[model samples]
Target: MKIIGIVDTTFARFDMGSAAVDEIKQYVSARIIRITVPGIKDLPVASKKLIEEQGCEIVMALGMPGAAEKDKMCAHEASTGIIQAQLMTNTHIIEVFVHEDEGKDEKELAFLMENRAREHARNVVDLLFKPEKLVKQAGTGQRQGFEDVGSLRG
Candidate 1:
C-alpha cells in the first residue's frame, strides 16, 4: 500500500521530521513526509501540494515539549494517549516526543526522545491505523534491505 505520512516540526526541541519517520518505517513501507508549521502557514503552494496533491493517508503530527518545565510527566503522558489530527481530523496521529531533564546533552536527550516517540508511534499505528494488519515480523529484515528504525533507505 502506498501511504503518505506527515511529521510536524512545530517545536524546535527535537528533529520531528526524521525522528517521526524513524518510528514508522520499521512497521511499514510508505512515502513519509515532514512539514514545518511556518512553511505551511506562510507558503500556500507547499501546503497545497503536501495536503492536496500528495494525498496523505495518515498524518502523524509530531511535537517536542517547549520549556524544560513542560517536559515533565504531563507531556510524556500526553504522548502515550490518543489525539486527533490537525489537517484530517480522523486521519492523523498526534505523536509527541518529550525529554526529561536528567543531565544530558541535547544530542543524548534528543536520541532518547526520538526512540520513545518512535515506539509510541508504532503503538498508534498498530492500534489505530490498521487494526488487522500483522506487524510483528520475525528476523530484523536487515539482510533483506530493511534497515532498522531511523533509516532513510527505501
Candidate 2:
C-alpha cells in the first residue's frame, strides 16, 4: 500500500492540517502519516525523514506564514529547504502556504487556509491516483485564490 506524509507546523492555524488529511482520506485509501512541528522551518527535515525512513511516496506540507516581513522570509527559507528535500528524495512535496495577509480578517484567513488545504489534499490524491485530471486542467488558469479562467472564452 502507498503512504502519504503530512507535515504541518504549529504556528499555523490548527485546522489547516486536519482539513488536508480529512480531504485526502475522503478521496484515497492510502495510509497517511502525520507529523507536526513547532514552525514551518522544520517541515523539510521531517518530510525527508518520512520519505526516506517511513517509506512515504509523497509529502504534503502545510504552513501559514504570518503577515510580517520576517515571517515571509522564514517561509521562503522553509520553501527552499523543502525543494531541496524533494530533490534529494526524488519525490513530490506539495507545499501549501496560506499567508495571513491574504485575507481581510481572522475569519477570512481561517476559511481561506482551510479551503486551500483541502484543495491541495485533492491535488495530492490526483497526483498519486488520477494524473489525467491535473493534466487536463493545465493552462486553464485554474490556480489558488482565483476562479478558473477556462481557456479564455470569447
lDDT on C-alpha atoms for all candidate structures: 0.51, 0.89
Per-candidate TM-scores read 0.52, 0.94
Candidate 2 — which pairs collide? Answer: none
lDDT (10s digit) by residue, model 1, range 82-124: 2312343344444544434531667766766666666556655
Give per-residue lDDT, candidate 2, residue 84: 99
Worst 10 residues of 1 by lDDT: 138-147
Q: After superposition, how far is residue 46 of candidate 1 from its true place, in Å?
A: 10
Candidate 2 lDDT by residue in tens digits, 36-153? 9998999999999999999999999999898999999999999999999999999999999999899998888878888888888998999989999999887776665435566774
Candidate 1 TM-score over all chains jointly: 0.52
Worst 10 residues of 2 by lDDT: 145-154
Q: What's the CA error at residue 114 for candidate 2, in Å?
A: 0.5
Assess the local accuracy of residue 70 in candidate 1 as a C-alpha lDDT between 0 and 100.
44
